[model samples]
Target: MSKKKTAMPKITLIVLLSISAVLLILLGIWLVGELKDSFSDPADGTEPGAISTSVSGGDEVVMLVNSYIADMRKDKTLTIEADGVSVKLDLNEAGAPVDYDELESYMKSKGYDTALIGQYKTVLEAQGEPGSVYNDEYITKKIDELAVNVDTGSDTEYELIEGGVTFYRGSERTVFDKAALADSVKAALDAHRYDTITVSTTKEAPEIPDLDELYTMIYCEPADAYYDVDENKNTIVVDHVVGYDIDIELIRKELTEGTWTEKTFMKQEILPEVTAETLPQKYFKDLLGQQITYYNTAEKNRTVNVGLATAAVNENIILPGQTFSFNRVVGERTAQKGYLPATVFQNGGMQEGLGGGICQVTSTIYAAALKAELDQVSRYVHAYKVSYIDLGMDATVYWGSLDYVFRNNTEEPIKIVSSAKNGTLTISIYGKETRPANRTIKFRSVVLETYMQEMKFEEDLTLAPGAEKKIRSGMPGYKVELYKQIYVDGVLQNEVKINTSKYSAYNGLTKVGPKPVVTDPPVTEPPVTEPPVTTPPETDSPVASGTTGEDVPVVETTSAPDPNSPGI
Candidate 1:
């Protein structure tokens, strides 16, 4: 039984070995077949990444594609029609056709099929490009051909207009649509790439200007130069002006030819009528009149008032035919104006008041005007005679009530200059002398009548027995006639009666003791020693101090004749 079992085991082992060999053989064959399929050479033996277009079809197909594209690119010229205007584009130059390599690439990418031709046709229809190309240099050259020489109507620059533009292109005298032409030109340029074509414009231009407005702008009125006096600077400033006029025809032609610019007008300069060289320098040169008056400088307030008025009148100019007003020129005299109260003729007697001495200024100016032969516009005489001026020559001025006015009737202007010094008031008028030099003028006064003032006495209780004192002094009155005597070569030519004056008398009074009183001999008081008086330097006139002391004199006198006194 053991031997039989052992033999069975051996047989099983052999069967297993046989099955293993068959599986080994099949695995080898299958592996060899896979290797053969993996390493085999491709059809036509071309390298990788290489393009091959060889096919069963002949070169006719490739040639057909090339010819079709070329024909489409170079078949005929492109025509741009807008508003009946036609423009042609040329495409025969180099780099003007489609690129062959580019076309091949497009065809390959899309693949060969019956629809490929239809695809090309679709591109043509969509693009609407006759040349189907873009050549910048060629297109610019063609554009140059359309340029036209246009007259700019300017001598300075010669300009030309570009682009083929016509008011009537196809139809006879038809209104062309400029907007459509511009739009079509731009579209054609964008849609097609031409080899040599250029678009330009040319048309008649019109320019018009408002002649009236131009005239207003170019014309200028001639002005006269004049002097402007700066009072503060004490200088005469000259104002200069210039005038201009335009050439009308030159500007008109320039505007019509569309060449008018800012520099186109021709201007003419006009000189000023008055120039600095011809300006007046001196209005008054010669001395025409002069006069002097006397004043009591001891009256300090009166002297100061006179000085103020004189200063106001000094350096005053009166133009030809201009009137001089004393009140207006002197202004109002008040305490604010530096005036003090002094003796003035009021109600036929001397009264103390403000601006009492200003009348002296008016009197002095009046006499000076008379000597100069100035026209007297208005004058007022005082009711009573004054000690400072002649009876007929004195002129009194009051604010708002009275005024002294005189006019410069001479052909030349006149100026007034005044000064008060050494108890004398002098007024001089300067102007071009028109009167004859040989003629001399002087004033003459004739006393018509004289009357003495009545004296009266008054009782005084303050004085001792039988003692008397003069309270007021009396002055004599007189009526006088003034005349102006004109002489030529010391021979009297004419004597005309000018004015008549009447002076009123002033009353005088004396204070006297009313009754004598009996009294015993009084004891004698010690003698008081008085200060020694020094003798003053001898002068022709007696000068009194301005103090109102009891010893001061009422009237001051000078050795020189009192020019302001009556009948001077």
Candidate 2:
């Protein structure tokens, strides 16, 4: 019996200790939950134990405080009352008297913990002193808003038509002093008066536009019709514009007499000198004249230069009395322009030069222009005769210093169409055909005098003794006269001398080795002297001949020809 009682008492003590330990654990959990609720925000709809001191939670608190202040200020309104003008504006739109930091410091000084700023926003709203201080920034902003609402003048209306203009008058305007308005608002706010603040404004009459200046702005001189190229490269004609003019004195008299209804005035119409219909007719319709010339396609650089120049001049139009400049059209020839070095006639000799063989193109166009009967404004002849054309027919061009220019003497506009293809270059002039069909014209080149070429020798050490190599063949010069002959129905009418050309002679060049050294042939059989045989006087033999009846000097010997020599 004693052992049972002792064991039962010990078991009961153990059970009581276990129940007490469980109850202490539960109590500790409940106390922790209550402490968590104290720190949490019930307004945030979070669980009761959720802590509100986290980084995001703190930012939310700050945002809520700022939002509250903004809402309170947004609901408030201020009225700017002036003479015959009133404007209402939300207080939030105005710049605050103090920035957020200053407001926060002011609130903190009032024994309000800004860290718990969300709770103190209502307290600040109730007090309202720190947020409502006199702010020059806010007062100026409010004044500007009120000024925009002032009764300014209505917009003046005007319209310009073909031969007249009309104007409509607007209402008179009123303006208030912005500085005075701002002072009134500041005073009212300083006095803590929320009533409508009345301020005065000055009335202003509507300004009348200067009729003289308007006349100048509206007046314009007539413009003639002109041709232009559109983006698609099609030739287009721009129509002429009629001019307008108005008398300011008449307008002033009407205004003084008070007889103006719509303030309307009739403008004078000035017609253009050249209307669209009066522009040159048959533009590029009729083929005036064309010339075709052959070129060596193997001369690749020269061919390229010819193509470039031709492309530059192709489809170019020259109005009547306008000049066409070859150099201006072709531009400076340089390697950058893709002009390669080729054989050119310079200083009475053939040498390599940029845009070398383009003279053929120039000469061809000159012929076409002559056939078209255009006026030659300026033309220069080559120093030496070119192989491609007759002696006096070729025209030479050099950029900046020399140019071949011609004027469109005809009344109609002229167009130049040029192309280089298949070893041939053709240039054609197109314009209205005013010439008689029965009339014909031809050019004649007459040789006046001949200058024979002379042989030139240069000593060379590379060749064997007494050996010779021909560097260049000789070119004979000539004084030629160009004539223009007119005929009617295949009958000669008249022949007119055009111009004279003097071509300089180019001397033939030869590289000769040193003369062979002479030695006595062993003095065998003393040489016997015989009476000098009389030789017939040496006659000059013609080595080269021209079709125009010019004589060329004879060469003493012949050798391999220079491959780069300029030859037709």
Candidate 3:
């Protein structure tokens, strides 16, 4: 039994030793495999403190995924360009990490069937254009194609009427065709990136009308005819004006539009302003167009025509602050104007047939002008002052020489209304009234003193061969001098002289009545040679004052007196 136990022990010992050795060999093989997997190639020497915790055998999978993402990032690019601008973009990791499940679904949705490959790796399982092909260059190219040219019209720019537009990029051509380039450019312009630029050009504006082009006239047209003041036949018959065509509309337009102001410098226009000017006694020339009558108690009734006429100053705006003169407007009246032959006061006496009745027109104009209170620039009275229009308020004219003038010192337009009838004349002013409507004007003629002078009058005188007959022959003539005064609103404004008529002295002529009857009878019978038998020397001795003899006394003409004599 003892020998059997010892042998068993030895056998067990040997078996145990053999098994332990095999196990040792297997353990060595396993260690070599693990070392190869863990340190396939020793980490680089420069690497320090690299820590590894979770990934041991699957490290290759993580590395592969990182490599794929790096590739995608490097391959990504974008180009953006439009108008004259260009830009490039390079993006890292342009693609995001692939979400396997979601990516698979997306791919499927994109009509691609994707399946997982070995080791659970998804190999573009659905090939969905890398999920979404991001071609930045393509987008940039599209935007560039949307570019446009904008044109802003300048001063000299030509008008644009457009057709289709063509665009070309190298050989790649496209047509937008009337796509409204302005709108396109507007859309493209970014104030943030641009500075304004300008272009030079020239252009002209249209011309406007001038003052010279406008010419106008003003005259009030009263109802024609006269007032029938017969009491019983008191009919107001309004007479129609012959050829009544007035440019009222045109005048109104000019006034309101201020166009009339353009002609402020016309040579003959009157500016109703008060200034220095000399007016002739006959200045109111406009009155010549009318028929007028004069009442002179000293003289017989007479009808005369006006020389000139005008409206009252202020009543008709003669444009404030302007110059106005009578001669400047009335022009000259010649025989062409038709004046009747009549008597006229000359050099203090009556002269026949020149320019007569002109005084009537002048006188009437004076009264009207005074009544209107126009600044009296010039005025004159009469020789033996007549009373048609009051005393100091009289204007007399000598045709082409004297004139009357006035001015409008106001700020508006004025109308002059002058009219004449068979025996009456009127000059009215039409415009803004500066004073109260009830204002009154008065005139006065205060004769300072009459200057009397002696003059000779010639009575009827006649001469027949040798017989002198006188009938109402020589007489005495006298002259008078007078003064005139003017008043306004009960105030005496001025005083003037109305020169009295001058008279000439009458000359007495000697007449001798011859004894001719007896001498002639003797000569015829006795051969007429006896010293003409001076007989009837005292036959009819200077026929006494009234007899068959008519005496003619010659009186020197007042106006034509002497060529070398000075005037009194």
> Could you give the C-alpha RMSD of every candidate to the true structure, in order shown?
23.0, 19.5, 30.1
Ranking of all candidate structures by their lDDT, best first: 2, 1, 3
lDDT value, candidate 1, whole model: 0.63
lDDT of 2: 0.72
**lDDT value, residue 163 of candidate 2:** 71
Question: Model 2, range 1-568, lDDT digits (tens) per residue?
Answer: 3543347788999999999999999999999877556455445576553435444554455466666456545655668876667776555554334245644765566655454553334335534525444556767776776666776675344577667778766566766788877776666544435567776777775555677778888898999898765554434678999887788788766554553347777888899888888765536788888888878787788888888888988978887777888887778999998888887766646678888878888888998998887888887888776666776878888777878999889887788999999888899999988989999999999999999888899998887777777876777888999988999999999998877889887777888887767554332344676646986675764443324454433323565334223332
Q: State residue 243's C-alpha deviation in candidate 3, in Å.
A: 32
> Of models 1 and 2, which has the larger TM-score?
1
Over 4 Å off, model 2: 1-225, 228-281, 520-568
- Backbone clash pairs for candidate 2 read none
Put the candidates in TM-score order, highest first: 1, 2, 3
Give lDDT tens digits, candidate 1, residues 330-363. Answer: 8888999899897776765566788878888888
